[model samples]
Target: MSDFLSSTLLFLLQASRMTILVSSAGLLIGFFIAVAIVGACLSHIPWLRRIGNLYTFVFRGIPLLVQLMLAYFFLPAAGIHVPAWVAAVVAISLCEGAYIGEILRGGFLGIPRGQIEACQMLGLPRLDVLFRVEIPQALKLTAPSLINEAILLIKASSLVSVVGVTEITRTAQNIASSTFRPLEAYAAAGLMYLVICGALALAGHYAERRLART
Candidate 1:
C-alpha cells in the first residue's frame, strides 16, 4: 500500500506538469481560433459566416476521441507530421474552439441593442466600437462559460494519452499497469483533477462577482 501511494504520488506530480502544459497550450491557442470563428460567424459576408458555422458544427458535433485520432493518424497521411504533443494540442484546441466560439457568439447576441446604437451615435469607428463596447460586455457575459470550458479542457487533456502523451492520466495508467493497483492510481488522479477544477470554479465565481459589482 505504501509503495502504491508513493508511486502514484510521484506519477501524479509528473502528470500535473504535463497537464498544465497541455491545458495552457490548448486554452491559449483555442482562444485565438475561437475569436476568429466568432468573428467569421458574425461577418457580413455570407460565405464567411457559413464557413465558420460549418467549422463550429463539425468540430462540436464530432466526438473528441475521433478528432484526436484523426489528428494523430490521418494528418500524417496528408504530409503533415505533427508530434504527439502538438497533435494533442491541435485536437483539443479545435474541439474547444467550436464551443468557445458559440459561447462568445451568444454573449454578443445577448448585448443590449441600445449599447450598440450608442456606440454608433458616439461616432466610434466600427472596429473601436466592437473592441471597446461589444467585446467587453461579451467577455463579462461569457466569463462563467469560459471558466466551464477551461475545466472541460483540463479534463479533455487526459485523452491525449491515447496518442502517447505522458499526461496525468497517462502517467497514472503507467503506474497502475506496473503496480497492478489501478484503483489507487486512478483515485489519486481523480482527486488531483478535482482540486484543479474546484480551484478554477472558485476563481470563476470570484471573477463573476467582481464583474457584476463593476
Candidate 2:
C-alpha cells in the first residue's frame, strides 16, 4: 500500500476503538434499562405498566437519526451539556432500551404461569422466584434477540459522527474527503464493520448453543 493508504488504514484502525466503545457502552446500559422497563411492564401496578408502555412508544416511534440529532442539538439549548461521546451513547442507550424492553417483556411473559406458581409454592420469596427462576428463563429466551440488538447498535454507532464523535465511519468520511479516496476509505470501513459484526454473530450462536445444553 502507498503511504496515503497506509495512513488511512491506521486512522481507521484507531478510530474503530471508539465505535466499539460507544456500541458496547450503549448495549450494556440499555440492557440494564430494559430490565427495569420489563420489570415495570410485568408489574401488577397499572400506572407502572403505562409508564413502561409510554417509554417504548416514544423511543421506538422516533426515527433514530432524528433522535441522534435531538440528543446532539437540543440538549445544549436546554442547558444539559455533554461531550459528543456522551451524547451518542446516551441517545443510543435510550432508543435501544425501548426495543430491548419489548424483547425482554416478551420473554418474561412467554414463560408458563404454572412454573411461576410452582416456584411460588416452593416457598421462594417473590424476589427469590424472580432472580432464581423467572429471570433466568427469560434470559434464555431473550439471549438471541439481545445479541442481534448488539449487532445493530454497533452499525448504528456510525451515526455518532454527526455529533462529532470520531468513530470509524466518521474517520472514513474525513479521510475520503481529504484524500479523495472514497472507495478505499468506505471499503475499509465496511470491512471493519463486517468483521466486528461477524464476530458478534459467532458469539451469539455459541451462547445459544450453550444455553440449549443447560
The best candidate in terms of TM-score: 2
Tell me the TM-score of model 1: 0.92
Q: Write the per-residue lDDT of candidate 2 for residues 66-123, one digit (tens) a residue.
A: 8889988877898999898988888998998899989988899889999998987888
- Every candidate's lDDT: 0.88, 0.89
**lDDT (tens digit, per residue) of candidate 1 on 1-214:** 8876876887797678888888888888888898889989999999999999999999999998899989999778989997888888888889888988899999999999998899888899988987888878988999989988989888888988999999889988888898788999899999889988898889889998998886
Off-target runs (Cα >4 Å) in candidate 2 are 1-3
lDDT of 1 at 189: 93
Candidate 1: pairs in clash: none
Cα displacement (angstroms), candidate 1, residue 181, comes to 0.9
lDDT of 1: 0.88
